[model samples]
Target: MSGNLADGERAGAARPCLEIACDESGSDGENLTGGNTDVFAHASVSLSVTAAAAAVRETRDRIRSPAEEYKANHLLREKHRAVLEWLLATDGPIHGRARVHLMEKTYFVVDRAVSLLLDDPEGAVTLFREGRRTFGEEGWRAFLDAANRLLRVRPNGDPVEIFYGTADSLARAHPGTDAARILERLAATRPRAESYRAGCADGPPLIPVLNPLLPAIVRTAALWSGDGRPVTLVHDRQNMLTPDRIAWIEQTARRAGVGLAGVRLVVARDDARVQVADFLAGIARKIASDELNGRADPALTALLRPYVDPASVWGDARSRALLADPVAG
Candidate 1:
């Protein structure tokens, strides 16, 4: 929203607001400690929920990369060690494997966000001091800064928000909180499991503006291979995303201050009112194809459906089937 501004003012102020989310999915790794299974390769995704943008360039960057090491343990070091090392510069209360719990690189994604906006990063720490101090924000800002800088993007004026959740939350939750049932479920699995039922257990949060860090969150929504490597960038490509996915992605776009509807108006004026829905329609058809071919799971595709438009999301099908559904054509 620009108003009463000189030409340069509008140009410089064209920054976007973004709500970012990052989460990692881990499969049951073969190696188990005390019956606890380590997470497999840690993957990350950063999404921008805006009017007419996506991580297509970023996604292609990832896909184009020559297949390389995708192992979690190999890439991620323990956070305690890194933090403690910075704290003491030598041995202290925490040291060695016994003193610290090894964490994956995924844990650092949020911290990256914080470093983006803050100078000394104490800017974030001061905010934490106001709370119970579960964790510091400075580290997150630093990580975020690194990401933005890595992408050669400026941070100022781009509204950014971040959080961590899990696929467990996306799954249907049943009533009757039973500790016994929970314990039993964990015991039944060959590999041990941990659930964050309290934090972000209420389904995936919408981060409309896809920013530098959103890939980390969207990673959770994608389909993972046997080793937890992300197989599909968009989950909705699995079966047939519904109007529901379009509806949600619409919210995400609006929340991020990116105007897909507006973009369609300028670039895709033909039935632009339903461009978002049409884009998603294509994504849904892809998901259906994958399901029939055993390439992806229905649940995963359902999530991707919310992010694409029916008519142009996938963009093709001179010979593809067209649905005579309510909103189509």
Candidate 2:
């Protein structure tokens, strides 16, 4: 699997460009709070179409499942544990060619709220890291719930009213507490919400903090473009990547000093590389979710460690500990 262009093609280029296939799992758009899945995993793979197809064919031969399309679930069943281990092994086809960004949904909401509502987002994040120890679990839960509601964009509701109402409810529920103080600070940012509403009234509605996919895509582009090379991403077709959103992603990447050549959308079934990425993403999400729930399989965890991106948006101490574990590497 390689991303190198032909020498003739490279001759006229200012810098080398690599093209990679991408797919995601557990994507519920901006519905972070009421979404079906708690984890979002986006995967990118550098494999060529032929190489990816061969890998898939080999896996299918090993599993011998009758299904027309292979998915992560086929590899996850207990009966196919050996095949799963082999697929994720360091010596496997995807070893160094893949990357996955796994985010815990609740944590993402908290992070977004802090960034949007607080003056010192970093300080607020550090304080919130103490979790139930600093603010009682119930109080913390209430704050997160309120924040999620305030940030979401509804088709028919007044966002400004939702903002103040959410903040007021939290203050009433947990008066004089740390959580309430946070909500008070958030209420002070009512002007920001008003600005958002004004902007929405003028143009397409914007919920900057709701969707996690944009940031994830930016980070993935940065990772693939680490050598100062431009990256062209081939992704599974998704409704969220509208023309405006794709332009935003490209502009954001440029601002961050990453050279993103372009983004191309294709049906996963038509593209073998995208299919391979789909499998990797789905499996990674399930494994990460299991780890979050304290039901991780040790062997699977070890196999998955190499592909987990270090900058993934995980906000729990257990998640940090998992990343720090030398044995898993």
Candidate 3:
């Protein structure tokens, strides 16, 4: 639980990377006519130290839940439930102690990035444009700091890398493609990254994530992103209990070309597989304690405060529920 992959392997640990890939899809096919939302899944196959096919299956067996199988419909529903509860406690207007704690932690990440980016506004432009730079010298330095901070741990740490899949980075991987274009428009509208990058505020990389094969609603979005780097595909608030749907999403994700994972929460709109409200709410429930008396400590509060609700036409009812929960948090 506390070592890097290499260190764990050296210690003869059981599972190394804990690679979990999750995909989300609907009967409506992930776009356009948005009726009949069918399924979503968090499919994970853990490979063990033996590095054999048998180990792979074993890993899959150990981690695979009835809710984590190829059949995603049921899993999808359950996950949604879990996410909904989380949203209610943490981000709901009323103070859910554990929910606030998670929000505060979440905000730190954005705050750290924004601080670095805003340090030298002019410098950011030159580093990005003039040089075909993958993290310019300054950027690389910042990257190292961010990476270190992100990977570090403490007592009662967040075990899951819940937000691994990044949207801008993903779209950039396949620039000029349909998905990329849609992401571009999303970049303009989505403020997810604004808290982190000043440049993002100008022409943001946080764009609408889409599956290119779905030809139903093809809109022009930002095409150039990530600069063709390896970006992880994060499925937010996924519920995949059905094998058939899970299989379809697995295949679809592969066709799109990116690593995927099942994340409990993410911004609700766009292609983010999960809902941000749900994730925070889930964390609220997970960390809730009678001793805290419904008030998340500074640490817990830090983790949950930053998540803003991403609502569609009707907005999110899930976020409101957290507020109604009894506050022995």
Predicted structure with the largest lDDT when compared to the true one: 2
Per-model TM values vs. the true structure: 0.18, 0.86, 0.21
Colliding residue pairs in candidate 2 = none
For all candidates in order, the CA lDDT equals 0.26, 0.79, 0.29
Cα distance off (Å), candidate 3, residue 78:
11
Give residue 292's lDDT in candidate 3 (0 to 100).
26
Sorted on TM-score, highest at the top, how do the candidates line up?
2, 3, 1
Query: What are the C-alpha RMSDs, in order, of all predicted structures?
Result: 23.9, 3.5, 20.3
Candidate 1 lDDT score at position 317: 27
lDDT of 2 by residue, 1-329 (tens): 23455667656567667888999999887678667888999999998889999989988999999999999999999999888888899888899898888888888887886786675666455545754454566756655566676666643456567557856775676677665677667777888867755665576553267788888898889878876778999999988889888998899899989889889999999999999998999999999999988888877887888888877887776775674233321
What is the descending lDDT order?
2, 3, 1
Of models 2 and 3, which has the larger TM-score? 2
Better of 1 and 2 by TM-score: 2
Q: Candidate 3 versus the native: TM-score?
A: 0.21
What TM-score would you give candidate 1 relative to the actual structure? 0.18
